[model samples]
Target: MSNGPAGHVARSTVRPNYETGRRGPIRTFLRSADGILIDSVYDPGAVVYGSAENPADAGRSPTRDLVFVVAHGFTGDVDRPHVRRVAGRLRAHGAVVTFSFRGHGRSGGRSTVGDKEVLDLAAAVEWARGLGHVRVATVGFSMGGSVVLRHAALHSGTVDAVVSVSAPARWYYRGTAPMRRLHWLVTRPEGRLVGRYGLRTRIHHRDWDPVPLSPAEAVPRIAPAPLLIVHGDRDGYFPLDHPRMLAEAAGDHGELWVEAGMGHAENAADDGLLSRIGRWAAVKAG
Candidate 1:
């Protein structure tokens, strides 16, 4: 709940206007794509760029601008460094909104890895749309990336562009060499104690389900909307091949950025990466 060293809390700070303490009104609506009315809210600061018409609804608009939505990684809130960095850059250009996942930070319920996150994303998108973000773009990290991928596949028509940095399309984490070790390390009594007793985190189920709830199963359904896949060369956790697989599934519609020394969406404030993402979003939103 404290700000970063720079005094910025990214998306964690509660907006005074949203008296409920939850972002927006925490409302729910049924999305035609998924046949579910999910929870969501419009960011008070979100704005439409370039077009007068809302991006979610295609119609005559004064400007066809874009809004950027920032999603955080696993165990991370909207105020994490990565989210803050991206939010700062995107906000400098226009409206930028970020929110915590359910059961994470200020939201309600427990983390569902990437499954329930789809609902969280739907809510965020709906909120952005309500704020007049006619052209919506998303930037997500780690597990957040997987959520974005799933959302795009389900609501391709509404999402104008997506930037998934450090997301592995297919999940075989328990099979990866390092992940194998890390899994052993984390699932052990000591690690489990830290995550459970120390952090008091709850698992969806105990034992036997370490395999990431993969989003690769949803990749084939995503396309047409421009997607940029950014991965670090040293990300042993997600594996480099994961991005390659996701890009391949994109079938010439997606672009990949493997940073030389980057790791898991690190250095998000770097000028080059920021510029690339911003430009990519601009072009895609158009």
Candidate 2:
């Protein structure tokens, strides 16, 4: 966005417009910058790119050159029902791109949790670009939500807009019961066993060589790029402070929405909320 807060990258911010239709999904496996194989799916919208010969048809569509790149939560993959539902709802606003994180589903490599998963998201965003999309809006949930924030900070000029749903502001938090249990899964042998066998998520054993940037820290760097931080008052893993901290760091550059009676992540996101997110991403990216 604005030279990465004075001397970070000096790259110019990207502002775009968007419009949408729908077709079958095209599945593909792509390689990340780190040589990991990522399982990805592309859902084409109603009108093909460059297919609207008549001006009226083009005017009728609102998401012609836009794409929504969805990043799922921990333990989620491309085939998950919640993820599918999100893609289905977002198709009405633009084309959708969903992919498995490194250690989830058909993707290859162990999960680094939120650290290395940024590479996975980078791969998916690149894949969307190769599909002829000019506008890219990243929509992430939970752990994926944190990843998107870091990705936007590290890979500026790639994403037109960002929507982080239910993300944590900092790292190593153990206040919540679910978060305590999650730390166990990532730090203990038996818990890792359960994660592999029960949750089907293969977690890496090594700790972060050097701790990466936190979501709150990344927020300040995303200035001039539209960011929407959505949170629920009833999230089990993270409390309202998580989103609030992020909003504070984002200052005037980001918008925060505290949904009434909402819970957590993709499992808790309803069709109505998803529709609003889709429409918001379209307008912001455009």
Which digits, one per residue and each the tens of the lDDT, describe model 2 over residues 1-286? Answer: 1211111211212222222132346676667777777788878654533345665444443333789999999999999999999999998888898989999998889999999999889888877876578899999999999999999999988899999999999999999999999999999999989999999899999999899999999999986779999999999999998999999999998999999889999988899999999889988996
Which tens-of-lDDT digit does each residue in 38-124 have in candidate 1? 223223333334344546544423222466777777666664566566676665454566776654554556555667667677766
Ten-residue region with minimum lDDT total, candidate 2 = 3-12
Candidate 2's C-alpha runs over 4 A off are 1-24, 47-64
Model 1 off-target regions past 4 Å?
1-64, 175-178, 181-193, 196-202, 206-213, 266-271
> How does each model score on TM-score?
0.71, 0.88
Overall lDDT per candidate, in order of appearance: 0.63, 0.86
Backbone atom clashes (below 3 Å) for every candidate: 17, 11
